[model samples]
Target: MNSGEVIDVTRDAIVTFLKVGGPMLVVALLVGVAISLLQALTQIQEQTLVFVPKILALAAAALFAMPFMGDAMASYMTRIAERIAGG
Candidate 1:
């Protein structure tokens, strides 16, 4: 592939990665921020209090987002394969 094609492929890979992982990360970040606020307000600083909810929220978000992730990966792979075959 030429430089332009290579850059395009790399950009697609990055976008796919962000599309797949971004939601859960965003959810975890939001949860952590909210938890921090709660801890500050209530003065409860147990580490598990932060860890467990973040994990649970991330898991739930990932589970909910799995279909979209799969679709995006499949779409990217198909485009890549087509480019390879054509080139």
Candidate 2:
């Protein structure tokens, strides 16, 4: 593949990665922020308090998003295969 093809592939890979991972990251960020705010308001100040909730939120998000993520990755792989076969 040429430089342009390489760039295109790289860009697609990044987008695919974002699509697959964005939901969990967003969930984690939101959960962390909410936990931080709660802690600030209640004066809890417990450093370990955030881990369980964040992990649970991320797990739920991943479970909910799994089908969409799978479809996106499958389509990306299909595109890659088509490109390879075309060349």
Candidate 3:
């Protein structure tokens, strides 16, 4: 692939990755922020308290988003494969 093509492919790959991970990441971030606020207010500095909820929330988000992520990745792969074959 030429430089432009390579860049396009890389960009697409990154976009695909972000699309797949975005929901889970957002959930984790929101949960973390909320937990941080709660901890601050309560003055409870338990490490597990912060981590466990975020992890569980992220896991749940990932599970719920799995089908959509799979479809997006599959579409991206199909497009990339078609481009490669055409070239």
Candidate 4:
């Protein structure tokens, strides 16, 4: 409830967010970079070429990462609820 508590909660929220979302983000970034490199090498400048692969990769990543993401979010929520109850 105080400034320190608020800072701690905010910091935890950010860490939880990164933990839950980092995999998909990294997947997206890597896919995008790879696609860009392939396009550069092949001289394929089609702007729409990146979408399908990135989408598929991100979907697969999300699917594989779902359980970990869920556990992280659940833990974060539990901690927040405990703090609230304690206060």
Per-residue lDDT of model 1, residues 15-69, tens digit only:
9999998998899889999999999999997877888889889889988999999
lDDT per model, in order? 0.93, 0.96, 0.91, 0.97
Candidate 3 Cα outliers beyond 4 Å, as residue runs = none
Error of 2 at 6 (Å): 0.7
Q: Global CA lDDT of candidate 4, please?
A: 0.97
Q: What is the lDDT of residue 66 in candidate 2?
A: 96
Q: Write the per-residue lDDT of candidate 3 for residues 1-87, one digit (tens) a residue.
A: 789999999999999999998898889889989999999999998888977888788888888999999999999999999998999
Query: How many angstroms is residue 33 displaced in model 2 relative to the true structure, after the best TM-score fit?
Result: 0.1
User: Candidate 1, TM-score vs. the true structure?
Assistant: 0.94
Best candidate, TM-score: 4
Per-residue accuracy of model 2 over 1-87 as CA lDDT, tens digit each: 899999999999999999998888899999999999999999998999999999999988988999999999999999999999999
In Å, residue 25's CA in model 4 sits off its true spot by 0.6
Error of 3 at 28 (Å): 0.8
Better of 1 and 4 by TM-score: 4
**1 or 4, which is superior by lDDT?**
4
TM-score of each: 0.94, 0.96, 0.91, 0.98
Best by lDDT: 4
Ranking according to lDDT, highest score first: 4, 2, 1, 3
Lowest-lDDT window of 10 residues in candidate 2?
20-29
